[model samples]
Target: MRGWGGTGCPGFANLDKAEPLKRGVQCPLANETRVFRISDPETGATCRYAAVPSSHTFSSAQQVCTSCFGGQLASIHNYHTNAEMQFWGGIEIKDTEFWIGGVIDYQNQAVNCHWADGSSWNYAHWQQGYPQHSGHACATFCVTDGLWRSASCAQQMPFVCEF
Candidate 1:
């Protein structure tokens, strides 16, 4: 039940994941890097994620996370995780649009999307009528509505790392 960023998780009142932090308080940060860790007691599954200190395009961000954190871009497998990411880390808010662990290479084949971490692309919260791809495209999540949109893999933006 340790808080992230080694700062005793300022303003965090509990370890319960169901309870979001108080309004106006943000996730723990170490020198302006947003980071947090969550574990499911029932399954003993834990995930630690952070907004990468540097922003880059999708592929570059992937390389950065792999080299620095030994992790991949944070992947959203379900609604709960996505919501937790939004609430606990604000990874997307780190930028107007931030890179997540998703890339779309298959044309209009949402089922074929893959995460950099090699996680199954079981869930997606795409923006309306999105995935209009002609070739390879990457995914970007926006905080406005927590919806994902397709973007060029070469677009520079903030990203998250998870392991």
Candidate 2:
């Protein structure tokens, strides 16, 4: 016997409409230790380090690193250790210049830098007799033609926030 309805398929009119589900916005990785890689625009060098804290003045960067990243800025144990060949250290920021993590030793007029592996500044990466101590005591990373220079930390500039 033939069916009463002209169409053999069942009607979907009785089915309920599929509503779109709303999702909450959230960071992919929250409150977790993660490594971030940053590249220098001028030098074309890439640096990878565990999460970075918010970018702030030299003094503020220290505080944030201590409170957030467990200690001062991170350092590169051996650039060659990582196949990537680059790392970020706890250098300070002043104006548009980057200063080694060290402050005036008082006894000696040398720039001291902090290392993440609990090592002191044995190697130096100054830019032709830098850290001129012009009354400004802050550090910043330079991405321009110059890699790291001394500048007033209070000055605002674009910084790379890791964590």
Give candidate 1's error at residue 17 in angstroms. 32
Give model 2's TM-score versus the native structure.
Answer: 0.44
Backbone-clash count (model 2)? 18
lDDT of 1 by residue, 22-80 (tens): 34222323454556776655456667776754568887777655544546788887777
Question: How does residue 130 of candidate 2 score in lDDT?
Answer: 62
TM-scores for candidates 1 onward, in order = 0.72, 0.44
> lDDT for each of the candidates?
0.67, 0.37
Tell me the tens digit of each residue's lDDT in model 2 across 73-108.
Answer: 444333242222123323322233332244422125
Error (Å) of candidate 1 at residue 14 is 30
Alpha-carbon shift of residue 97 in model 2 (angstroms): 6.4
